[model samples]
Target: MSERVLIPRNRGFLFLDSHPAGCERLVTDMWQACPGSADMPEGDGPVALIIGSSAGYGLAATLAGLKRAGIRGIMVSFEKAPTERRTGTAGWYRTAATADIARAAGRDLVFLNGDAFSDTMKNQVADLIEQRFGGRLDYLIYSVAAPRRTDPATGTTYASVLKPIGRANRTKTLVFDGEGVPEVREVETGPAEGDDVEQTVAVMGGTDWERWIDQLVGRGLLADGFATAALSYIGSPLTAAIYRQGTIGTAKAHLEATARSLNERLGRTVGGRAVTSVNGAAVTQSSTAIPGIALYTGLLRGVLGEDLVPPVHQLAALWDQLTGAAPSDLDDEGRIRLDTWELTDDVQAAVAERWEAATTDSIADLADLAWFRSEVQRLYGFSVPGIDYAAAVATDIPWPDHTA
Candidate 1:
């Protein structure tokens, strides 16, 4: 292993590298923040298969499951490993670090890294379920967010785009590049073109999720009372045109529909339940890329200030409801809503005022751009407080070696 002082390779909100030690520290922090006894609880331990369990809500839900419910987890994800001169993806290090923490707490966490959209990966997880989990699953969380996906049957690739549905809209967006002040610029987002919506749906939709359930149920791997959730976002009206009313919205709608379909099948057969958990907007890799999201989330964070609930805590609350520790918050459409606090009228009113008041010079003051930028850095294990960037550190960190 080579030791070198490493810094962030950042371009605006996009980070190209992740710090291994920093990522480990993040995992440790989240683990400590989680509520539950560290010791694995008694009884036949619950089992979960979290697809895309590396970063964002997926990682949060993964930690919530392990620490809150004492679940033995099988996390499926795709992340690049570090090379000699370059750092691995944040999700890569996070998964490894999580495995380390889980092992220390005497929990079972098996991580399978590969293309999650592939049938090969499904077969791999299925084999593990049969061999290691006694062919039973208590929960299945799908939190995959990818730009493109290849159809396993047709050998076709579908790519998702961030665009409005019918009419293009112009909006002010916030962008952070390096240590400089965040840039506020007006940009016109175009409408989705031919096949754009369908392709986006194909990549980001519920078909893959349905396929996973179908396979598991067909194999009799789902336990009685089995429950599943796919993470989703229905943004504020400010972004409704570009997000909730856009191509991504179409995909998420499909996902929610899949949940209902699966709910029927599961309820009829194994007394299981399935639903989409509509999460609140925050600084995530996907959110930063969307044209107006950075500005919106920044203002939202600024207005909320100390009252802002981190995604992990919100997800922990979801965990509570999912396990029946509290009543499940189901909307008229029968989907769990984790964004209730974020989408309140008072909050939206404040955010809209700030949005109107924002300019290039006052953007930082009107919105929490600095905080949003820092959060993105933390996502990739950079800009974490207490980390000694001046000191040399190892970049070639190993993934936690384990097998079913």
Candidate 2:
């Protein structure tokens, strides 16, 4: 086995083979957090179809659906295959590990690897549902994060930008060197221009999500009284400029509007519900790449302390919300509030104090840099407990029969 080194790029860590033990540990943690089968309502649980179900919140929801509700599922993702010189992405291994666990428990799992935005992929999923699962899906979860998207109708490509809307906003950013030391540097981003917001919306907004729902309904793949949701976030004020009030924010605003339209359409057409769940901020591969978010996450962890929630925990909460066991907790706009605790007054006050005091010298004391770094490492399937780092693991693992 060659020496495994953590390479820090501007975005996030790049690594080779995943620690199989770590992958297994992730599955174990998810199950431990899951609701038991007996706790669920009587019946073979709902049939769930998850888009972008390879990593981050999407993957967590997939695990939660199977373990918590005993639901059969189909996952759609776009990931690379392993090569002789390199291992596949961490998501590939995570999915493989999850499939093994689900199969052992007698749960049905199907994985589709392709561009979810393409028409071909949509047709394939609809056909598979018709042939395999009796042509009816009860749930749909959309959680895709991509830098660029190619429109299937026009074949035009649009890219998402992470700039503030009106003016150049100056802020401090933390850049890690893969050695646990982070340097704080002042950075500034110019405003978006020249249809930048439009492009971002075209790529990351709710159009693709609405399209998926429409296609599924048109093919009669969605069962009556089905439910659908797409993930969104409204973070702390510190990140509002670049995130919530920026180009991405414009896209999100559009997404929220679409959710309202979808709710009405789903309710009338299939006696179903559609919602956009506002989630808490967590360290994800995409979040780490944003300009000011890493610094904000470190401070948030410092203030929230043990109250900080990971993706798995958030998914568990979502399960409880979706199952009608608890209150739906809808806000004035009719969007679900899964992030209410994160946006509390006391938590924001402490984060604000630390945000002002944050600097290169004060970061070590004011922010939870260690926790942030560990989460980033975990995203790449490293820094996990009980993993033999020196083992010569096979790079290419076969996909499950259903997915293959």
Candidate 3:
């Protein structure tokens, strides 16, 4: 006889509202919904800041680092979907949920509803640091994943053009159109070379990351012994053309190189180090969108859950390194081989080989399919516990009281 709970934001769609307070409540709800065991452990001296702490792997990074490393710091994100004029965006709810969780834990959490790529938001974060917490941060995470960006000065738009590296590379990916597993065929390779590569780099590359660091340091807001890191990925050669060697790959290369440069600059003031983490492929919203990623992720998920650690766990290990408990050798060129344990040379080679041999007539492991389905569902905020799904809920949201 319970009433149904009505979520403010629509399910399965990315939405945003300008209200920061409601967004914070949504975040709290999300945190409560997650299984308690899902939280990573926090070591001593937990002080961290997470940029782009909203969805996908970015949210995982925030939770893992905070729970494991004990970093109870602020979170900043640039979610441009819902405004007060257009309430009930996914970000607004996510922010609301985040605030609730932080309050319960006696931790500090701040959600900035502006463009992370802009100097204005950066300035706001700087001012907040000065006014509230004495301008000191131990750990900084750069985990923004956007498909496009516009040059504030030139007014030119840059986007990540999904393309193949060399010639037209055709491959078979998983087709989930049906309830059963099927192999789908793709052709015409991907985006053309030259301009495609440059455009992709411009859109997804390291410029924004560099600017963030610059703003924090320039404002004298960064604390001593600061450590910063960004996430990256490298999949098998099947989609290498479209992923690693393609447009997105070029941007990642830029990011990898930029980390070293930023580390050197930050070394002077904060004696800080820049790290690049090669995260595992989880069933995140972004991963689902990438071409040829679902099948690989699905097959690897079951295998990883058995033998290897998950991406969240990998994040926890990385947090240990950031806090000086673990050695840097745990990572590679700022890239942590999170999937290496599960996707061992033997494991990955086997998956690639099986995928090549797999035909539409072939039957995949039923268990793998089920795991994939569950993971995808978990990504969308479904299957969450605690809240009464059938309870009558009000759609009205409380307005945010952002100081800035």
The candidate maximizing TM-score is 1
Writing each residue's lDDT as its tens digit, candidate 3 over 1-404 gives 21234343422222122233333443454344343343445433446678888765567666665565646666776654433245444444565565555555655666677677666777878887777766787778888887887766577888777777767766666555434334544545655666888888887888888887877878887887888888878777666776898778889999989888988888876788887777767666677666777766766654455654555566766776787767764444655556566546877776776666655555265126666764554443433444444555433443234453
Off by over 4 Å in 1: none
Model 2 spans > 4 angstroms off? 1-21, 35-43
Positional deviation of residue 273's Cα in model 1 after best superposition, in angstroms: 0.8
Which 10-residue span in candidate 3 carries the lowest summed lDDT? 10-19
Q: lDDT tens string, model 1, 1-404?
A: 87778788777777777888888888888888877667766764689999988998899998988877777958999999888757889999899889987787687889999998998998888889898878898899999999999999899999999999898988888876566677788899999999999999999999999889888877889999999999999989888888889999999999999999999989999999999999988788878888889899989999998677777787887788778877999999999999998999999999999888888888868877668877888999887877887888887777777743
Writing each residue's lDDT as its tens digit, candidate 2 over 120-224 gives 999998998898888899888899989999999999999999989989888878887655578787899999999999999998899999999889988988798
Clash count list over all predictions: 0, 0, 39
- Order of candidates by TM-score, top first? 1, 2, 3
TM agreement with the true structure for every prediction: 0.97, 0.94, 0.82
Error of 3 at 346 (Å): 1.5
Alpha-carbon runs more than 4 Å astray in model 3: 1-47, 80-91, 178-183, 330-334, 384-404
C-alpha lDDT of all candidate models, in order: 0.87, 0.81, 0.64
- Cα deviation at 231, candidate 2, in Å, is 0.4
